[model samples]
Target chain A: MKRTITLTVNNRPGVLNRITNLFSKRNYNIESITVGHSELEGVSRITCVVNVDNENIIEQITKQLNKQVDVLKVTDISDQAIVSRELALIKVLSTPNTRSEINALIEPFRATIVDIGKDSLVIQLTGESEKIEAFIELIKPYGIKELARTGTTAFLRGTQRTSNSTKNISIV
Target chain B: MLQETAFTKMKADNKPISGSELLLQALEKEQVEVIFGYPGGAVLPLYDKIYDSKILHVLPRHEQGGIHAAEGYARITGKPGVVIVTSGPGATNIVTGLTDAMMDSLPLVVFTGQVATGVIGSDAFQEADILGITTPITKYNYQVRNIEDIPYIVKEAFYIASSGRPGPVLIDIPKDIATAISEPPEEKEINIPGYQPTLQPNYLQIRKLTEAVSSAKKPVILAGAGVLHAKAAAELKQYAEQQQIPVVHTLLGLGGFPAEHDLSLGMAGMHGCYTANMALYEADLLINIGARFDDRLTGNLESFAPNATVAHVDIDPAEIGKNVPTEIPIVADAKEALKQLVAQEGKLPEHKEWLTQLQNWKKEYPYFYDNTSSLKPQKVLEMLFEKTKGEAIVVTDVGQHQMWAAQYYKFSKANRWVTSGGLGTMGFGLPASIGASFADRDACVLAILGDGGFQMSTQELAVIKEFNLPIKIIILNNMALGMVRQWQELFYEGRFSHSKNPVQPSFVKLAEAYDIKGYEINSVEEAETILNEVFSNNEPALLDFRVDPNENVYPMVPAGKGSHEMVGVKP
Candidate 1:
């Protein structure tokens, strides 16, 4: 099973090292992780995707992550209603002959041409992970020159919030 | 001229001092009385401050010895041990001790000096990436980059090291930070958001536990070091007696429950007693209080307590279901949980038939040894226990002798037995006993070792002689690594490899060289008189006993086998 976990941590030196060291030490498989500044000052939110076999392992990983001193809170939003997105840049090998065809193919997916080179066009897309995978498969026929992706970043849907939102903002 | 003017201006209003002095003040504020440390070039600044400070420093010959001594002190006194050393080699030497303390949950605060801040990543002289090396082993670690952060970092280090689920913490201080002069930082409250530990159990969970206890017929309580760490031995004893339940101890939990009690089942693990292991195998309700299900404690998890429902109580939430599938999980301090169970309104059902069955097993398969031929290690341990009246703080190095000591010594009080249970490090006994002796001057401290282990840290004998600590050292010289030899004989078809020691040193002569009293015993008949003389003397002494070389520790559970299928049980 795959789990999506969100963590609020102190924005300090080696905080990322500490979190990743914990994952490697405990033998947890990390699929992807994205870290950025949170809503609070001097605090960061880490959205991570991990693959484990059972619910018990997920619980164990959450508890272990919570043990780090810099980590403020850990929330497993895998089973909850979550709004998630991932940004990807795909450079497709193309010539002037297939440019219109490529533009027409990406129009329905709301992807835009961010860059155009002599023999390639870079398309930037933001959506759920599954949608990005489908887009890559559709454009594979044109030959992908290069690709880069920002791993999944997520939030709970509606009014539900993680425990850190209820904490005082001055703690960080 | 500008530098002098600025210095004078700073000293006029707010007094500024070096980071080393600030660290000393911080340690004094924490009520630290003694420190076990070794000095080097990287830590020269701190050592200069230590020279004028009032704190007493004990220098072991090696860095590893100092840390092990600190661990021993922590185990006996329930206080976090403090250690300081220099960079590179000095810092690397204490890695084993750090891992040992981490695995066994001993509280330790170790400070390691680093190269100058500018040269840290440039591979300058005596530089090591200690923080990266120790991240997995330490509960928490820090590196001081600024001089003003010294006071709070020291305070936080002590707090985190001694708090819930106690373990080792390390702080790496750069040379420039230690030498820099700055105004002392204001005292701040220690606030760590993610580090809060649950100290009290949920009332609903307590109610459920009591209900389970009331309905259990063949209940057993498995205790571990957490009981001792929480100082809840008395509470555990009361609950077990009130419920008429049998209690089995993990290796580190030997002294947490009285071995003389009628409901006591001594030590359940690989080398555990037959009755204790059998009770766990046949238990109907296994109420595990603070013991992690280590693989040695649970042989072949598929067959381990298959008939029982396990209820695990641990302070660390991560340990609850890591190895075994727990039916009831309580994350709280062991002492608090035990008190709640005792105070709950409930009466447990009587288990008369179960008690009888356990008693029969105890009588049928008691721990024994053949005493007709050669001197035996078990016999020597029995004599030591009788001589000390089971009151001494018994520490043993890792090997066959460690198992014998755990088996023969019946501890009736908490915090009286110390051994390297988790990491099983060699050469831990001698220095740890030296550390244990400092806990109380009047209490007798014993270091039981094997020939192979004693030589690993033999340099620590100088510390005993210099301090004149009243420590009794016993070396069971079998001329081989006894545990490995035994395994090779049974599992590897007697190949023996390099297990046998063809050459050895005269340990008694080595003790004499250190200006300590030394005695040697070669026969079983002379063992009693020699042991008597060594124990009665007030001075430190070492005893070398040449025991049988091929004798093996029995009542063994083969790897991947069930506990009930133990070999060497007397019919």
Candidate 2:
């Protein structure tokens, strides 16, 4: 069975390497993962999206991490119904005419203009994954100069907060 | 074939496997009956698989207690003990239990879950490098990366654990591998070179040792746990009688020799009889069978049995000269070595005078207890034997009460007594009793534990409750760590160190909580009559006897002191 598992690990060194190694060792192809320091000190959230055979193995994989004293919490946000977003900062080659059209196209996606130059334009967009993908697709026509994108991060649907459980690692 | 998609084709034969599933299959293949575990992140996959498996799993109150039960099971039945745990803290908690089993030379397999491979090097949450931590203590250790290696690693772990000078083997399974899939694991095999445990008896050496026994003027046989584990009791008993020599035992050596026999010296050393210790101090020949010469027994080693020539038999060759020097060392199984010695057809020696000497010592010391107007633990032990008539397999946890049981209880044959002698391990009796009763389901097995030791692993009462196996628990409620307290009083100027943990759990209430039969005896009549009822009923019973607070075990010879220096009383 193909599945993606999201893990919120403490922000610490080697977590990315360890998670990637976990996938590589098991041959779990890591499609993408977004990780960074969260609002909490000494803690980080990691969202790993992978295609794998068993969804239950996430429990096993994360439980192993939970056994690590430093690891605060692990969760699978894969199936949660929520807004998933990725931030992309792309520098596109732009003429004044295309830049105007680019700014117009970026308007609906709520992207921002970070920089402007005679030769290039930089646009930053954050939205649900599908919207971000559409924004990237629209800007691809301008001939991309540089692209840096943070992977998907999500939270549960209307008023269904996952914060309390994460605060005190409840396995059930 | 057109009917099946490429993805389906790949799913049928080729797929990436994780370390977790491999671990689960390996355990399944080992036919592991049960595992005791408390789940955390690193081992979550292993637990997840456990959820799907049919194997029995016990959740212990603590990690150390989990493996202690495993050790007890292994020691009692001669099987490999298996415990599963998460990495880091969970894995580290089990080290003491592993160490205890290692010191006793027991067979145990401990499996710990590790963080994923990629996150291991990084200071990832909950990550601990367990392989580095357990290397010094374990007999063998492995960290598997590939799913194909799981079956092989687990098979070898069990083999290395139970074979030869038995000790613990640890396997660390990374979480990622648990989720990995394999095309069909390879036939598991042990491929490491030169790892065979020695099993054959050395015939020439056995012949020489037998000759020495035949020619000795004052030969005494000393048996230990090896005799019981190897089931060499009958051979040892016949051989001693044939040669007409007395048998002296270590604390662990108790039931390996019949306490009531003419040749039986019960136990020797600190608490041993006046004659047995004195005779051993003067004997011309010492047949050390299966028991290590613990320092507690051999005071001033240079002065111990000064005239005796030693013939040692043990499975571990390293133990032959590890402590007291051996005149002749035969590295072989205790049962096989004894069998070979018996097969040599040697003539019996003349030791009636020596036998008389031990008999005189038996009369002199004769493990005594004052018959008070009220109840005493001695009376309970006496009643336990009389009511059961020495038919029960009696287990004693280490402490003052253990020595008392060794002295008062009579074994018609060997292998019926199981105690943690080498380790002097507390909390050994209860779980061992469970395992022993499991071995002989029809036999009446009783565990004698102190209040201190009972409190340590009393959670095993849950197991007792689940099974209702008719094993009687006799708790000597002294309200202190009796053994350590005795030492503090004798050697530490009586400062009353941490040995005194004054507050005690209500054992009767605890018994009720487990829903087992429970009673308390304050009067001698209550002890004798209630004990008879507990024994006759044959249900699992617990007897909490409030004992004297300041009572000290007699025949106390401080460590490193000679037999002449043994203090039978305070100055």
Candidate 3:
């Protein structure tokens, strides 16, 4: 199964290298990773989606990540109530006849046609990964010229902070 | 070089000192007494500072020897070993020692020099990615980019290296940083919010463990290096004796309990005694304190202690239920948990039947080898133990001789038996023994090495002679890698391959070359006389005993086999 893990690390030099080195050393397969400054000052949050075989691997990964010197916190919020989103810019071939049909298909999905070209239309979609996939499937018949995804990033739905332990002592 | 004199001139001025001065001050603050090192070009600044400081510096012939000697010092004194090495090969040389310390959980603080920060990635002379190479092997590592961060980083390195499940920590110092000007650090505890280790055990869990111990019909305590690291030997002994439980140790756990005590079952695992292995196999409750259940100790996981309800106590939470399932997992220091467990009331009756069964097995299947051959390795250790009256601090290199020493020499106290238990580094004994000797000059220190392993770091003999350390070095000349040769004989149709040593160096000549006392013995009759004379002299000496080359460590549990299926036991 694919799991999303968010790691809060101290904003210090060589931290990213350390995190990536740790993953490679432990043979953890990282599918995608997105890092940016978190709400906490002088700290960065890394959202990583990795492919793992079992729950035990996730536990080991989290424990190992917690052992890193710069990593302040690690949480596998994969099973929690989360708001997950992905952004994709997909270019699809649109003839004069198929342009209106494409508009009709993306009308309910709230996707926007960001660019119109002579040979194709570039559609920008930002939603849950499943919604993005649905939009792509509908537009596939029009022939996708190119596609780029920012990958899935997520956070808990409530005000619960990962740094503070919740009452739920789930999987230790 | 001028910075040292300037810092000394302005010592009372409250002026900012050079980075080297700050480094020395941090060492003084930590109360470090000794540093094992081999200086080089990149570390000249630190070396100059060291010369001005009051700390004792031990210069080994090689960088690897320096690290192992530091390890020896750490193991004996219960202090974090400190090392200073230059960049490139100097930093890379300590990899084996670092891995050994990491595997065995020894506390070490190593400082390595790097090229100037500007030239780090430019392929400058004597530059290497030391932090990158050592990240996985060390407990924690840091690269000192800013000279101002020196104090905080040093404090953090020491804290991490010596706290909860201690291991090696490395700090890479760029040349420019060390030469830059620095100021005195504020007197306060360095706050690292991410590094708090849990020391106290959960009382509820301790209660559960005590209950299980009280009700267990056949209980055994399997202690490991964690007991020694936590300084919990007293608590462990009391808990076992009060509960009338037999204690078996992992190889590294020797001396954690008195080996001669009736409740002690010696060591357990592949080359462990029959009594200890049998007790582990038959126990109804196994209380493992600080042991990680390494493959050598556990054998087949599915069949290991099948009848036991395990209660594992360790400082590292990741070790719990990692290899084997646990009924009660208490994440805490072994000493604290054992103290709490011992405080609980209720005197459990002695399991006389189980104890007698273990005794019978011990008498029936005792560790034995053919004694008809001349110069038996076990006989050599037995004689050494007799000569020393089991009162020496013995360090060993890895091989059959190491196992022989483990089985034959009785270590009655913790920290007295030092060996490379985890990484099994070949060149550990001589340097480590030299380090141990420095820890206590009055104590008899012995280095038990195989012929092949003794050659690996014999260069340290020069350092030993230079220091006039009265370390007795014994080389059991088996002329082959006995352990691997035995494995091939038993499991691989006896294809010796590279195990045999066709050509060998004359160790006595090497000792003579170093101007140390040297002796040679190849027959059983000469062992007592030679050992007695050499040991009585109380000087650094080497004795090469040409033991039976075909000797093998027996009472072996084939790899991945259950401890119950030990082979090579004689009637």
Give a tens-digit lDDT track for model 2, residues B153-203. 888888778766678888888888777777756564575332544466888
Model 3 lDDT tens row, B1-571 = 1223444445557788788788877777688888999899899999888887778899999999999998998899888999999999999999999999999898999999999998989989999899889888899899898887887888888999999889999999998888998565565677887777889999989989888887888999999989999998999999888888999999999989999999888889999988898899999999999999999998998889999999999999878887888999999999999999889986575589999998888778887877876889898998999999999999999999999999999988899989998888998999999889888888888899998898899889988899889889999888998898899988899999899999998889989999998889988778878887888777888999999888889888999799988887774
Which fraction of the native contacts appears in each prediction?
A: 0.80, 0.00, 0.47
DockQ of each candidate relative to the true complex: 0.63, 0.01, 0.55
Best by the TM-score measure: 1
User: Highest lDDT: which candidate?
Assistant: 1
Docking tier of model 2: it is incorrect
Residue B219 in candidate 1, Cα distance off native in Å: 0.4
- Which stretches of candidate 1 lie above 4 Å from their native place? A159-172, B1-14
Per-candidate TM-scores read: 0.96, 0.71, 0.94
iRMS for model 3?
1.3
CAPRI-wise, candidate 3 is medium
Model 1 lDDT tens row, B77-164 = 8888899999999899999999999999999999999999999899989899999999989999999989988888989999899888
Point out the higher-scoring one by lDDT: 2 or 3. Answer: 3
- TM-score pick, better of 1 and 2: 1
Worst 10 residues of 2 chain B by lDDT: B1-10
lDDT of 2: 0.74
The global Cα lDDT (0 to 1) of model 3 is 0.88
